[model samples]
Target: MNVKQWMLVVCFLCSGTKYIPNTCRTFGSGVVQPFQGSGFYVRSNCPFTLTRLTHNRVECDVSIRRGKNGLLVQVEIIINKVRTVLQNGNILVEDQSVSLPYDHTYENIFQYGIYTRLRSSLLPLTVTWHTVPAGIDTLWVRTAIFIRKS
Candidate 1:
């Protein structure tokens, strides 16, 4: 965690709102939830939502309200803050199967998942997003990360 992240984490905790310690950040209107990973993890600068479609399935959607100016939503799916995959135009998760959102979300997915199940437990991953205007264009991004282990 950097100084800014530490400050944000402190702010969230000081206000009586519970947030994952040392993790979670608020960039512009974007709210990113931090996860413990073994070098491969995901972090977003814009707003993203992980919706539960079923008991054991979920979907991740990222929306950049503006800066696109109705032109297009271009995104760079960065993994471990190293690898980069450029995704142009609108994000069409529907075009592909929900079983692997990352596959369609990014140009090329280098994660662990399949049509039946995701091999996430075997290799924890990390990601960070970079938009056109970056995090300097928006004021707030509403995001939520809900995980239920059963």
Candidate 2:
């Protein structure tokens, strides 16, 4: 093969064309009572310019099992004031579905759902949670943010 052809192959091999998230970060909030009327709480947040995060994964877990309904959790990505739901991120069980440790202490259970497209809103991107668990279960939420540069 010629030098130029070899160089082209090497470059292509070095940098694959597949779009991969360049920055991946995980953040969590302190213990919170989702069943309360507090509504949504921020789990992870980051600032972006023209380029924005394209995917997110949410994790929910609780230490106590206070009711039969289990903890119903919903994951949302809020860019500025707009909200986008990560499908399958809404979990019913606290530890089983979310796959968190089965202990009396709070833990973070991550279950990545389908990837969703997101656009920048000239503000910081935030991952929030809303729950319908009627119990007084103490919960801790975590979110993973995957970002790509435009």
Q: TM-score: which candidate is best? A: 1
- Colliding residue pairs in candidate 2: none
Against the correct fold, how does model 2 do in TM-score? 0.19
Name the lDDT of candidate 2.
0.30
- Model 2: C-alpha RMSD to truth? 15.2
Q: Model 2 over residues 1-150: C-alpha lDDT tens digits?
A: 799857855665566532222222221232233422343333322221112333333222212222223332233334333333322343333223432221222222232242222223232222223332242122233223323333
Question: In every candidate, how many clashes are there?
Answer: 13, 0
* Alpha-carbon TM-score of each model against the true structure: 0.21, 0.19
lDDT scores for all predictions?
Answer: 0.31, 0.30
Per-residue accuracy of model 1 over 6-106 as CA lDDT, tens digit each = 99667766666653222322243333333333322234434333211111233322233223232213332222222232234222333433323444232
Q: What stretches of model 1 exceed 4 Å from their correct place?
A: 20-150
Model 1 residue 141 CA deviation in Å:
17
